[model samples]
Target: MTSTPEPWGPVEPLEPALSVRRVLTLERVLAGEPEVVAGAAQLDRPVRWVHVAEAADVGVMLTGGEMVLTTGVLLAGDENAQAEYIRSLHRAEAAAVVLGLGRAFPTTPDVMRRAAERCGLPMVVLHRPFPFAELTEEVQSRLVRRKFAAVSLSEAVRTALTGLITAGAPLQRLLDEIAHHTGCPVVVTNLAHRVLATAGERPAVDDVLRDWERIARQAGGSEGDGWIRAELGGRGERWGQIMLCGYRGDTAGGRLLADRAAEALVLHRMLGGTSAHTWEEQSAQSLLTDLVSGVVPARQLLPRARAAGLPVNRRTFVPLVVRDGDPAQLERMLRLLGLPGLVAEFAEGAVAVLLSLARDQDADALAAHFATRLRTESGESRTVVAAADPRIVWDDVPTGLREAQHVADAVADSSAALDLPAVVRLRDVHLRGLIRLLRDDPHVQSFAERELDGLLCAGAGDDLLAVLRTYLASGRNKSRTAQLHHVSRPALYRRLEAIEARLGVDLDDFEQAASVHIALLAHDAQQA
Candidate 1:
């Protein structure tokens, strides 16, 4: 499948947060160092950066990197308070605390001094007054210098790689060297988009696929179409993402820069991983290659299969396809699948579901029941078609995927012709292909138009589908259905009667129920 299109914008490279080593310290400032503020303590500084405040609890509220200025107004009123405040500052990991020479205490409180010494936190006392703005300007200038250096370094690396490529140099050594220098996992994706090399612990493919779409979108179509774009923690499990805790000194540029570097590394390898293969450019074609070449080898498959928590040595795989639209509905279905032994991947607007081997001959029934349960939970009028085949080990995955595709396609095509409600499935068809199409056509569209025209015209198609889907979920239990919809049973009955009357189908009759069910599946397919 094609990656999601990235949002359009002018390409801006991101950079990492300023290193603690780059900041100046209070001691350095007092010593007449032109750059006075600790780099870790300075924020938004073009000169030396300092903060002077008496807020007692500034420690927890702080994000380090500041030459903390305090008038000692909040000095510990008690021995405990003094120690606690100092401890909190230490925990906040501030670069240094600079106390004004004159404050609430006659001298540096013994307790405060002890606390700072115990915590190994830096403490400074200003003997002379200095303008806060001037200090800030100096610190900011140093930060700008650091950023410029980083940019220059990044450009140098880029140019070196480009030159190497132009000279047809081997990339493996270059990647290893880069990984060593960066100290981050280095992954090179092949021209076919399969990961060809990696320098860190590997993560599962399913986990990677989860964020791949978002990464693709952010990179944008044209922005990273042929070139590289970077982002942070937006894709996969390893090198994926992590909570920043708080915004702190993290600038948007820094976050972007880290991720872009990752993207660049991946793209560079993807472009250079193999001999230029014109055919591998297509995602679909690459998918075929990954399947045929056993990119996810049988040896790796078992670990992942076990990770998925599938039964060992069990055979048979069923592929289930999820229809698109309605994110809420998609979310509900996804929630039911936190268990292992099931592998799912999103292709286009649909999610492909893989079911491991079943226990017995009732595999199809089990699969159907599992699917039906998911449908009920989602309360969506979407199609879930399953293509089942006898249990095959991972070595036989290529055949399974191809077969599943055929089954899903068949179900999708056949269901379109039915006069069903909002949901459809492959097994819903008693016959295959054209015959199934004829059976569902009227109920699929015409019948739905007749019965649901009000909702359709009111642009309440979603609401109508939800209601219909929920009705099925409740097993047509009017009381339970009423409670879910917050409507009385009488009202629900009336609606059901209206639906039956409009469609000329009686719910009580088996033939009508079967017909309506088929029709619903067909309607959903056509919409899909």
Candidate 2:
């Protein structure tokens, strides 16, 4: 039942003082020889305040969570009034009722006892006369101290988190601090319930993620257990929430931790500027980069991948790279295609996508579909999608990612042969692939510089270079090269003759043309 809030004091997210069980243990209250009459199961309910009232209708004045101390002096003989009094107190949501027995019909009354037991309200009876003033003073002072302590906790957490942020600490360090304060697994997730970042003990966190689907489903709304979430957003745009999984504390303190943690996170993002990616994107980028770099063993990352909500058990992993693709748009495309994948921009102008598929699914078909849909959605018909053979084991993923990147780099060569497929692979790149791999070698660089020096040093270096690239890419067909360059065959022959004179090599010789083409390809790859 909703009641009017107290207006005189602080309405912190966490309030309320001691529980009924704790209150019973107080020396002042125990001096009265208090005995549990009924409703013992609810003794743990929080007692926000102490109210001493003899009026039968005192429940109307309550704002809930009050520990009411009544003597029953107003109703000595009326059974109906006694019963209705307990019923009214229960309706008021009082934490518990302490009855002084001397003036209120001696021993426990059946009517009041039965009513409190029915409503599950803790009912206590004092055998000796107890000073209501003393109990009220002790509980209220303690409640005030608790409120002050709560304020202190809030400031402490805020100050610590702020200090970390000011020191330019990373997101993981901030989350770790929050986890240390709460002593629970902390999870930050997107609106789609995908875990973006996590901190806490590894075993406990893994336990929380083991049944993540159901837990994510239940992430919405306030739950009775230790789960508390604080919505994370600013400027009226809520993108996600921060959760305290299985936090062991009062509701108010738990919420304070969550809200403070969330505020620190939002501030971290805001201060990080535009390059500050969403936690999920950053997480994926870190994971995939590590996988491709092979700095960390794949087994160590398996748990992190799983905790991040990616399927990694006995699944087929496909590695793909898109040249100059938008990571955000690619991620959206992955979702739209109903495929399970992680997309991140691991390198400048190069975005990597890792797809986890079931063994029964056709990896090739899905990959093709992804490529086709990406082109259509992006409206870049010539955009290249490079992929490697699907890997079944997690350990082989790094090799697959490297291979896919290699394929992507190979096809990025502008001087490569024409008519490349929509999705370029290792086999499709062929000889150009080898040249790309060797583009960085000193011998290859020297060879390319030596072979291309004639045209490169000429006045119309770029113009003639384009002509030569087209001529060689067309497999030495002068007619096609002239058409592609929008020049008549006579003009093209004159340029080709000049090229042969400058380079001192015949363009018609198969081996010479092939060597020149390979050199040009290497130069282009290096430049790219």
Candidate 3:
């Protein structure tokens, strides 16, 4: 990850809208001797606006979520009119209705009270004469201020995230910015619901991810508690979503934060590079790379693995490295095998896979099975599958990965002419592997050139070198070498004579053949 200086100051979060209950508790509104007459439980409804109306059909002139202030002068005489007025307010989805006392009626109307109770609409009655203008002014001013604050908060978050994006922050840092602003758990996921990145305060993130699958499934719909999501990507190319769970602030504010975070993430990914793989794969690649680097401890990554749907406890861990293989194909193969693990592209033409084995499973057999499956499926000639020893815990996975990677790299560097086994281990390429590991040593190069100098100075074509390789591979049998190369016995004899004349050595001697074979191996390793 690239680190850049913070370009913006901290942003203060916005206050949520004042609820009907909060409005009732205001000093000005409370001074009106307001008393809840019905639907006390509905007082928490958000009051978007405060309207003062004294008419029979005020509901028609008003929109929803308004706290209506009116005297009952329009319904003073008719009981049906009073009930209809309350029903109309309920139908309009009004937050609450405040009926000013004195003049409309000396006491609260029973018809309106019964109607409000039946419809579950909050009904408030002022015990004394109260100025509707004063109450409306106070509530409207507060509502406008809240709206301004929300807009300001949106701008602040957008600015902060844009600055971070410009600074080249990664996906996790963008999510961290959202979590910091919202004081909640933030999660980024692909279309497949795989967790890409998560950020928040510590234990809260843990609690949110403990049963991550269930929570994520529930999050698909908008039924969970304060789990707000903003879609990522645009122009008909939706890729993922950003979710905030257990946000303490208003849903609107949380949504603002999520939207801003989503925008920043989309821009960051676009600016970096384009790939066919989704962000989920990128997330897996980043995690695997981090594990391989060993800069962060394995224990710290356990939570992330678990959150990504890996079973981390009381299981066997099998680390595999494949050279010249496709990681996306490997991931599909794992799913087809009903295995739970992670697959990631480690480097060009190489992939890394972490498989979770059962306690009763045989590690060697499973590794061989995986290697055979890959060979059969991919049909790539030079595929190398290297497996590390099984680990029983998550913390030991990094060690296993390092071992597998080393083996894979060694095998990749080995001579391509050698007949490699379907599944390669460190022992398979023992001596040649050591030479390749030390290929950079000046002494090794000098030895190899000195050993093969006679044949090299002859200016011979590759045919003689091919003959030498086949002869050594055939265990120094002239008949087998001739048969393998499709040449007559006398022709093979002539080639062998020419080779000995050039190198001044007997092909039939064991010590001489061994030295030349070792030299050839060193030469191939150096070229590789």
What is candidate 2's TM-score against the reference? 0.76
Q: Write the per-residue lDDT of candidate 3 for residues 133-181, one digit (tens) a residue.
A: 8888888888788788878877887877877877777667777767877
Best by TM-score: 3
Encode model 2's per-residue lDDT on 149-266: one tens digit a residue.
8888888778778777767778888888788778799988888888888889978987887767788888876666889999888999988888999987787789888998999999
Q: Rank candidates, TM-score, best first.
A: 3, 2, 1
Better of 1 and 3 by lDDT: 3
Give candidate 3 misplaced runs (Cα > 4 Å). Answer: 1-7, 223-225, 275-278, 293-300, 311-315, 332-339, 347-350, 357-366, 376-379, 413-417, 431-528
Ranked candidates (lDDT, high to low): 2, 3, 1
TM-score of each: 0.34, 0.76, 0.77
RMSD of each: 21.1, 7.8, 6.7
Q: Native-vs-model 2 lDDT?
A: 0.86
- For candidate 3, the TM-score is 0.77
Off by over 4 Å in 2: 1-17, 162-170, 221-225, 234-237, 269-277, 299-315, 357-361, 372-382, 413-419, 431-528
